[model samples]
Target: MLLGYRASEQYNSYYKPVYYRLAESGGQERLRELLSQTPSIQIYDTIESQLSELAKINNPQRQLTPEEYKVEVARYLDGKDPDEYGVWVYYPWSQKLVHLLDEEEFVQVRTSRNLYKIKPEELETLKTKKLGIIGLSVGQSIAMTIATERICGELYLADFDTVELCNMNRLSNCNVYNLGASKAVITAQKIAELDPFLKVTCFTDGITADNIDTFLGTGSSQLNILIEECDSIDVKILSRVKARAKGIPVVMDTNDRGMLDVERFDLEPERPLFHGNLNEEGIDLTKLKDLTSQEKLPMLDAMVNLSALSDRMKYSLSEMGKTINTWPQLASSVVLGGAMVTDTCRRILLSETTSSGRYYIDFKELIK
Candidate 1:
């Protein structure tokens, strides 16, 4: 019911450190180790073998028409081994060959129900758009959401930080096994396993002034949308400056009170960066670093009207590393943020009625 994964897949989708049995490191070694313990490994001779079993289930009466059988048989007669044609990935604990579905077919099947609502034309428009996500804490959920929904052609993921124990509170993908792994690398690997064809570019060192151009696709096609989520206020401002200069739209989710921001530099080339929050020409963004809770508060106030935020958020900000080392974010807010950003991105890229603005999914307001 949830993106083709059942509740049983919860651990695999969110909790476990994602592992595969293929070309990735430790892949062959892990497979050999597991296979040594088990008596046999499972494999379907071809995709046709699996299809035949399904056909039997679909028609135990054996009443399939001659035309149906011919069409079905012709489906497999493309002169290539069905299992061999596509990339293969084995999820942890799976006991058989897991041939990834064809890229186009996978997208179509996974997002089939999202049609008409998202609109077929809108989905098509999203197909070729390039998206970028910086910082993989909240960004990780956003990346996974975008991947599952097949919203963009390529996803540029930027995150320099490695997993830390504190990160586990909100990063559903974090686990003890990958405690110190690079966030960008781990995310890229997960995306590849999810949709082999979902193009991914990782910026393990995170975006900087020198590399911002490359991350924004300067030498190549510019990104259609940027989902900025980095901790460094410097990169945050710098990225938008580049985005504004290049005429690319930007998106950001604060993961507090379900806050999401949209800046349409593509629509209005001269639009001020961050809606004038960084308008002071003298402000040296390069001097900025990952802000402490107190340092972030005043900057946040300028970016957002703090009065509009929930009481809980206002209370948390007052503590500033005393009661809280940083901002408090919940899984619910992070998940909601991912959906909000992607939906906003879709609306913008499709040239819909959606305009550049800020919106919220305030739980306090909603619950009341």
Candidate 2:
């Protein structure tokens, strides 16, 4: 009964949020009418909490008594209609209505905790940037972390696969309920719930040679950076090829021992893809698509530095197609990879770190 679901209405279509400004003419009447007709409506209001936080920001010198707080609130409103203040957001998927400050105020109070860590100017700059993420399994962590940080204004998510029981192990955002849903859709919905103001575009069919140009952007609105995490050997290499052509930086985390790759294609236009790992193995990029699964192992090995991998990983690789059905990944590593990639991408966007190389953040080596 949620949102009067029909067989024809796809779940992906409900990820967007509807907004109503009570200050606008007839806004309250429209919302009241809808609520009256709807059998189930969950309303939440947190505007007062937001106002208290705003008051603190303005009057950091001293605390306010309850009476003084009311005065401060009145001063802040300045005779504006209380019901008309802020914006009302309705989520169709959950049938939940939430009231909160508008985009500018919401962002300021929501991200106030990150003040010294992320300067105001830097956050403003980041809000104007766009990032594209491929392969939503481990990429989920990266995308969520970026969203929590309010790092970018828009996100482009691409993944051709759907959620499966096996993916729940490392994909924290996925659960049994989403087993049959598209990975990109799940991620987009989670992001919308977290911050409806942020923009999210889903590539349900995932990225391919056909749409790579549009994914990387062909016009003035190209992606600022590309996060490559797809499983396909072809896409892993192909994305970098297209990214390099557009002078967009690319970052990847192998989700093993914190192996991170940063390719500053924007800076080094001619840098070898994957730090030339394939070239070292004498593998030809042109013939990569022709290689069988078994034949592609060498390239994959080179891409992740197989010899340097932990003993358990090497053992897992040997057991693939035998003991285990596919490459093994742990929740801890995948989450760490998300954090690692998020931080790397943030720095890349802010120009804090500029280099092209493969680095390892092996826990065993660092913790000990």
Candidate 3:
């Protein structure tokens, strides 16, 4: 499920020239770091091949057997505890071994693209922040993308549903084995597999009115950013209410035409909820509970924008349970949504950009 490795930071200069000189000086240590990735030399096909690679580090010259090779390799590990071999990390749908880089090295290797956009000097700021993601549908991808890039040092995940056969359409990492497993458990496990260093707190009970305050951080610590993807309408509005009071930003992806909603409660304490789209359409938010499939259509359209909604979505709503049992969701749209929201969260968190109101990430608009 995950590939684990030990990592250490090998560079720290603010400038490239000085950093390169420092990295060059620690060249042998870097090589040892790279070689320490595998379980042991036994995993190698032949002892000669293992020693051949390690021999490059030998100052003079010496012959050694498979047994002696282990001792020689340990010398360059720089007193790293022999007890820990590698740290396991799971990145979304697939898994693989990557260098166990130090905090700086990991941040550098993982988020190079985030540089310039997120100034190198400002990288550590992201790690100091905490982000919370609720609902595992699109939120799972958002969580993974955040972890894959080491966006935040600590994360809080909340999801109550379980992986069902129907969920496979969008929840890609979950397979039969994960069926019946709570979404929060699944997401937390996935996050653990990806980067053990990332601190995660799971709310398996889901975010409810009762616990929303704690979720928002009742203690001294408050969430820096909140990504809400819950299905309960009450929780949706209530969460925003709490977020506004706490001055935390909220982001949500609808997975339709790249539709995303940004509520900058942190910036505007009195901002209207969901841009007041529901009220504008004469839609009653209080009547959302227990509505029939067809009855819910109008509210959905208003929440996501009616006129701009895709023809396919309009048709799906018209049919309700007739043609499709539920709203159609393609994996492409979900993943695109995950990436969009995560990128937006990154820009907003880093102060590199600001987002609010409603925006369409429709590919149709981008290409033509």
lDDT value for candidate 2? 0.86
Query: Candidate 3 — worst ten consecutive residues by lDDT sum?
Result: 11-20
**lDDT string, candidate 2, 1-368, tens digits:** 76775422345556678898998898999899879877698999977777878887768788888888888878777898766779999887678899988898888888889897989899999999999999999899899989988889999999998888988988898766677778898898889888989999999899877888888886668999999988989888889888998999999999888899999999999888778767634646667789998888777876788888899998998898888988888989988988888888888889999988899999998998
TM-score of candidate 2 relative to the true fold: 0.93
Q: Which pairs, if any, clash in model 2?
A: none
| Backbone steric clashes in candidate 1, count | 0
> Which candidate wins on TM-score?
2
**lDDT comparing candidate 1 with the true structure:** 0.72
* TM-scores, one per candidate: 0.77, 0.93, 0.71
lDDT ranking from best candidate downward: 2, 1, 3
lDDT of each: 0.72, 0.86, 0.68
Q: Least lDDT summed over 10 consecutive residues: which range in candidate 1?
A: 10-19
RMSD of each: 8.0, 2.8, 11.5
Give candidate 1 misplaced runs (Cα > 4 Å): 1-74, 78-97, 290-297
Query: Residue 256's C-alpha lDDT in candidate 3?
Result: 81
Residue 279 CA error for candidate 2 (Å)?
A: 3.0
- The segments of candidate 3 whose C-alpha lies over 4 angstroms from its true place after superposition are 1-76, 79-117, 280-299
For lDDT, candidate 1 versus 2, the one ahead is: 2
